[model samples]
Target: MNWDDLRVFLSVGRLESLSAAARALRIDPATVGRRIARLEEETGTALFAKSPQGYALTEAGQRLMAHAAKGEAAFLAGAAEVAGQGGPGLSGQVRIGAPDGVANFLLPQVCASILDENPELELQIVALPRLFNLSRREADMVVTVSAPTAGRLLVQKISDYHLHLAATEGYLAQHPPIRALEDLGGHRMVGYIPDMIFDKELDYLEETGVSRVQLGSNSVSVQFHWVAGGAGLGILHDFSLPHHPGLRRVLPETIRLKRSFYLVRHEDDARLDRLNRLAALLSERLRAEITRQEGLS
Candidate 1:
């Protein structure tokens, strides 16, 4: 019935869980339930069907969601227009969602700079196992290796990074020789979980004729740790490798896999000066880090 109720309804509808919606909105689950109950009562239809998995939207709920999305967009546009009267400097909190690797190894220095420049601005760094929905305002911005596919999002190619097969000197010494992809079949391989983004590493290696990789893991950091601890050969992003004495590039200059990092924000978010400034700062900082890491190898 009200904008706040519609906002809460949209959050619950998208996440399909009362608890998740509550957490995202920083409100209690009771409040979220009450708001939804009110909205449903006012509309004279069930907006959601409760299930063990989560809330399932009804047909009427689906119809309302389309209009809710447009209304939310207009509301955000109006808010940004009014905020812009204060000029271009950033204020308030900006939530940034990034994959774990980027959050851990890449964005720290950039975040520090942002804080230094705008002490009044708060930066919320959410380390997602995968990318979040920017269109739904789950995140104000995102940095990812995978390209953005959302129609209403703006994607910028920041820089390219290379992935390399790496192993500890100790492990390589004990394992069978890996002179070519064919030799990798007999050796154990540390890898990402089947459903994770880095499964491409395994697929690519298999396609290159190394069909028998011993799968081990899904976490990139864990895979790297295993490689450093002499567990097995693992494909690692070049930027993730620290100057550990035990770890070395397995094939050196012979094998390389490259992927680009993208900075993405919702197209509707373009008018928000705070979001745009944050995106620009992220792109500049990440580019420098990528260049520095590439130079190291």
Candidate 2:
């Protein structure tokens, strides 16, 4: 019935945890729980179901999802318009999500630069190996491997980065030999676990012509480091692998794969000067970083 209650509900629904919502809202868990209950009472239906895994939206809650989003968009649009009228530069929390590899390797530098410029802003990085839902407010901004063909959001290709089959020099030394592409099949390889890949963009292993995996993980950095530690061979990003001296590209001329980065932001955020500025900054830095990696490699 109240806008404040709807705001709290949106936060709770997005986070699915009372404690998390409280922390994000700068309030107490009991308050968040009470407000959610009050909202349910006002609506005359249960909003969320509690389970060991945390709260999940009920059927009633699902129906309110779009309306809640509309409320959020209205609020954000108003905030952005007010912000543009004049204040300190972008001064609100901005959450950016990306796969673990990009999160670990790329976003730190980008975030630092942003913070340096917009000192008053709060930046949160959701560095996980999952697909973020922009519509669900899972992240205000996201760096994904592929662009969405259908979404009410702004899409931009960050860059086309290259990956190559590689193994630790130590592993190469101790292993039998790798003269050609076929030799990869004889060696122990590290890569992503097929089923756990949350996005189709991460299904890189099937392209490598190696069916079996000696060691693997859902995190790209983990598999990369495993290869770096001489655990096995892996397909690594050119943009990230230059930092590790132990790894050597295998069949540098032959076994390279290319993947593109896509940046997606919600439609509500499109008009926000801060978010748009951030998107531009990210695109620039990403391209520059990829260039730096190119020279380093």
Candidate 3:
């Protein structure tokens, strides 16, 4: 009957792990387990089947979820409206998953700006080389390189960022000339490991007409630094180049790639005003960063 109890139930159910549920809620794992037990006892039924994989909902828990989810919607809507009345500041947590490049270069700045404006809001950034599974509740929202065509989801293309071939000036001076894409094979190339590219949109070597990678990493930051360390020519975002003065564009006119970032969330969650506001803020920041890099801002 307690709405707060439903909050615990939904978190545990969606995350499917007591520890993860606790982490998201900012509560002790023992507290989360106890709350679930209390909720099940109140309903006179076992709400979950406990296992090493964590908790799986019982038939009763599944039935209760529909109404609980509706309650959650109402609660979030009320919170959003109330927060708007006071000001545009947000409360509660938002977890965003993104690629290493954006996460390392952009998100920390964005989060700092957001936190400055909203001291009460909580933000978690998961920067990984692999794709985040939104369906599994890995993140409240995800920034992905490509958009999915099929899903009961809300998707928006946040930005189209450009990548250019680059290398340390010393390396460029010493290496074989890349007169053309055909000449790329004569020089050492650094790139994402072919099979480790979790997102197909990140499969950039083929677009560059260069497949012979002498050095590689799944982590873009590592690859960029390796290039800066004079390892080899690499494909790096134009926006990220300014920070590495030693790294010069190898052939900006020839080897280039354009990739779009898509923000996605479950359709039902689109109703949460806090989430939408955060997404809009991120979208605005992403576009502005690209423009700033282009010297258009």
Candidate 4:
């Protein structure tokens, strides 16, 4: 019944590791283990199954988790209200889960500006090429290429960005001239690994009838760099082109691809004023940044 115990329980359940929970909580692993034990004893049920693989929640733990999450959300909401009563500046941490391309090329300047404006605010960008579980608190918010179909979530379209086959001037000069899409077949291609394309929108090369990539990576930053290095031509974001002056779009008029970024957040978080403000600012800045960068590209 203790809030402290429930906090520990939630951390362990989400991370599935006592050590990781301890590190996140800034406490020792022994303390986290003791808290979980006390929680289990209070409920008179084993909350987790122990094995070499780490803790797996028991049926009782699963039930407790749902209620505990609601409590945690309420508690955080109250804290935010209290903190915001004194000032407009945001405090505390906000973590974002995004695909590498956005995280790497776009969020740096965007988040930097946010941090500069609110010195008390902290941001963490988790660059991963997989879906984030907002229910488990993998991230406070997520920027995704596609809108999620299921979840208690709010989705907003931030902006529409373009991508096209791009290569360095040096590479284009050395390789066979690409007057059209079919001419792309004569040159090496760098792109996403075929089977590892997690989102259908990301299967950009597929549109060009490129069945194979001469160099493939799941990370957008990697593919962008490969193209920048003149290793091979790849479908790259228009926003990213400003970073490499040597890079030039190939068949720009014919091969332009459009994609949109969606901002996603848990519906429960809508009650928090600070998050609402932050999300608004984030969306506005992202939209402007994409437009500004794409103009330069």
The best candidate in terms of lDDT: 4
Q: What's each prediction's TM-score?
A: 0.84, 0.87, 0.82, 0.94
Model 4 accuracy (lDDT, Cα): 0.91
Off by over 4 Å in 4: none
Question: lDDT scores for all predictions?
Answer: 0.77, 0.83, 0.83, 0.91
Per-residue lDDT tens digits for candidate 1, residues 114-213, read 7887787788888876658765577888887777554777899888888788888898889888887767777887765655554242344543455444
Model 3 worst lDDT window (10 residues): 288-297
Instruction: Give the distance in Å from residue 244's predicted Cα in candidate 1 to where it truly belongs.
Output: 2.5
Tens-place lDDT per residue, model 2, 1-297, is: 988888888888888888888998999899888999999999999999998888889999977876888777777768777766234466688899999888887788878887898788888999889888786688889999988888678899999898888887788889888887687878888888877888776777687678888797999879878888888888888877777977788888878788899889987676567778778888888778887886787
Give the root-mean-square deviation of each candidate in angstroms: 3.0, 2.7, 3.3, 1.6
CA shift of 252, model 2, Å: 1.7
Which 10-residue window of candidate 4 scores lowest in summed lDDT? 79-88
The alpha-carbon lDDT assigned to residue 246 of candidate 1 equals 70
Q: Model 1's lDDT to the true fold? A: 0.77
Candidate 4 lDDT over residue span 1-297, tens digit each: 889999999999999999999999999999999999999989999999999999989999999998898888888889887767226788788999999999988999999999999999999999999889887789999999999999789899999999989999999889889897788778999998988989999999878988879899999999999999989999999999999999998888889999999999988788777788889999999999999999999
